[model samples]
Target chain A: MKKGRLERFLESDVDNILYWVSIFVVVLTAIIYVAQIWFVNYTGRYDLLECRLKTMTGINCPGCGGTRALKSLFKGDIFSSLYYNAFATYGAIIYILFFVTQTLERITKGKIKGIKFKMVYLWIAIGVLVIQYLLKFIIPGYKI
Target chain B: MDNNFNEEPNYTGEVVGEPKESGKAKASMICGIIGVVLCVIGCFCCIGYAGVPLAIIAIVMAMMSKNETDGELTQQAKIGLICGIAALLVLVLGFVIGFVIGFASAFTGA
Candidate 1:
């Protein structure tokens, strides 16, 4: 039986499509984050996305200061970034890894190694969120 | 003692087990799991936006991989696809609920 065009495409080009889509997503995210940082730098206002939890409950959520953290990190303020949101540093590292992996996979025609999200990484991320949440309470005058 | 049959084993066109699973299927499954995890975390934290994009990517990858594979591997891809879609749904629902609540509060001047 002869395969249809869609079937042929699914069998042959799907891998390439996945690879390219991943690359596009990572690139787009990086661009957006950079633009957000630029906006914050110029406006001195961190109002990208409002925190619904904070607004409603008058309390800091685990990710309340994430945008500020990213902005501070971009501005070379490591201490301030950590004070704002520790996960920003780890998120930045993950973003860099995603960008490199996707770029390398494309350049090497999928010959280079591909990366997988490990369970350990997820656990570490969750742990960091918890730790940051706890620190927000323990540290005096810790503003979200 | 009649075991003197010396015939060569015919190994031509024999039925083998299912085709070897594609690496893409495995990748799809992993991505889906990660997406679901991120979405769950995002629901509590403030990272729902980040998870939504990842969930979309995972769903796409799973669909592509599902098209390329079959049998047990297809099952794996299906799991990935379901998880990815569920994560996206969770994120979208959260956003909608949050928006409605915020709007109601503002409208009521609460």
Candidate 2:
């Protein structure tokens, strides 16, 4: 009798590896989350590379200080990240939500629903990209 | 249009292939192409770090296209995804390692 695909997959050592890898990712994300919270609470500052770099370089990238924004966001400092870059904060939230939902579904062997990539959303993203690039280049006060 | 009553209808053995590819798949291929283009631009531009993540996403999406019924679209997506990932990784690593070294220099005066 031919073994079913599920039975074969379950029997494979790849399943065991995948299980451990997933655990590692979850634990690492959790640890990073905690560290981010601690850092934000202790420092009372959302950024480590903010004005210092901005001062040196006369230009800013659209994603300037986005890493710090991500850390602040993970620390539940929504307002802080928003202050840094509202779009980046929103993007991070969206990315995290999608990642978590899909990861959970995959782990549970649940069917993941397809997200319709709307034209509006794409246009919005493109607009944000252009605006951010312009702010970085044209508006010196908005650097970082 | 001819209407026949009670005559044994001849079955044409010609198998019409799958219906033309869905719009969704075509859109994904477009997105994958865009991702590759953005990643390449990011490599030359200062935003090399962002390229890696975007490229990775593109590669995953392209690979996911394997389940799609369209062969040509799948092939294009795969190529774009691979190129994007490779270029992005090289640029990101270069910058990341450079930053690490720069940071270490701040700690140890040499």
Candidate 3:
């Protein structure tokens, strides 16, 4: 049977799709990071999205300090990043891995293999987030 | 050699010989990609509420595709399923925690 146009395009253009998607992700992240810097500088506040959980419940969510953590990491404050949200470090690492894989795939014309442990990596990320939440709840003075 | 040249082309047989690829698998892969992208956007922009529905949709499509696919295509569906589930879990967990805490504080007057 003759393949549909969409199917043919998907099968044939996967490399190009992956390459462009990677670029898009990287560019978006960069833009967000830059915007965050400007927002913090002008507003004198780190968090743009006020945590609803914190505000309504007076308790931190699992991802409460993730933004501040990323901001600190981007600003090169490693200790502060960990202090605000340890999960941010893991998130950053995963993002970096994704960026590297995508960039490499684009450069190598799909010859260079990208990380294939798609589900495993995702599960690991989820596990880390859960662990971070548990640590914050169980350990005194361990803030998330 | 002359007998082979005399044979008629079996167009119907040719069409039937090739297996039809399932659209479900393709839809599953597309939904998964969209779900992951939206999750990233939601996380970065702090608008996770907007991403939850899309993630759920992605998970549903991926599961539907998973049953129809095999091998590498199955792997793609699995990736989508995992991504969608992860995004949904994160959002749900946050809301659940927030509500629980809110109720606890209300009862305790703390």
Candidate 4:
């Protein structure tokens, strides 16, 4: 039986799927970031992304302040980004560097070394995320 | 009969057991399932970007499972790959829809 297009695509090689999707996701993210910057510049409003949890519970979620952190990071305000969300600020930087190296390695056909993903990376994120979330509760004065 | 049962019946030391799956395949499957769960939660909740890292991890792990062959993947690896892709798609959709709606509303001075 002849396979349909969707079936064929779904059954395609894992590497090819990952490779293409990674590129697409990264590029889409970059475009969205650029558009966000433009929007902020044009509108003079940072109300685009509201913390739904804060609005409902009058408290911060684990990911609270992420949007502001991203905004600051995109604007190159590292200190402010860290103030908003320390882990997010550094995570974005690391992710960008990782992707850049990955692209270079691919383009250069492995001539350039790429950053390898490690389980420690996930562990670090988890630790930082939890600690920061805890700090937000323990120290009311902390900006987090 | 007891001695025959106890003594090795000229048994070659070949271990007769189920083949162990690769570490990468197992990791991929674990990460993929977690990624899907997180991504789904993220889509419905405020933490819409939560599962992006897990999805990437799943993808990387699945890719690493490839042996000498470029395209070949085990069953677990395939599950991981599919789930990772699905998670990514779901995350992107949630984020993009949110941004688009927000952008449209703000642009209309609403």
Docking class of 2: incorrect
Runs in model 4 with CA error above 4 Å? A1-20, A28-48, B1-110
Per-residue accuracy of model 1 over B1-110 as CA lDDT, tens digit each: 56433433347844455656655565566567657756765665544455667677667667667545543347767777788898888777776887788699899998
Show the lowest summed lDDT stretch of 10 residues, model 4 chain A: A9-18
Tell me, by lDDT, which candidate is best: 4
Model 2: TM-score, first chain: 0.47
Candidate 4, residues B11-61: lDDT per residue as tens digits?
686554544556566567656865775576465444445467768878887
* Candidate 1: count of backbone clashes, pairs at least 3 residues apart or interchain: 0
Of the two candidates 1 and 2, the one with more favorable DockQ, higher being better, is 1
Clashing pairs in 1: none
How high is the TM-score of chain A in each model?
A: 0.61, 0.47, 0.65, 0.68
Each model's interface RMSD (Å)? 4.8, 10.5, 6.0, 6.1
What digit string (tens of lDDT, one per residue) describes model 1 on residues A40-72?
Answer: 789887654456667667888677787788889
Whole-structure CA lDDT of model 1: 0.67
Model 3: per-residue lDDT, tens digit, B2-96? 55533445766542333344444444455465455445435434533445555665566566554444534465567667877877766566567
How much is the lDDT of residue A29 in candidate 4? 56
Interface RMSD of 3: 6.0
Q: Report the lDDT tens digits of candidate 2 across residue range A47-141.
A: 53243334334545455666567779989998877656655676566545545665676667768642333445545655765665666566656
DockQ value for model 1: 0.21
Rank list by TM-score: 1, 3, 4, 2
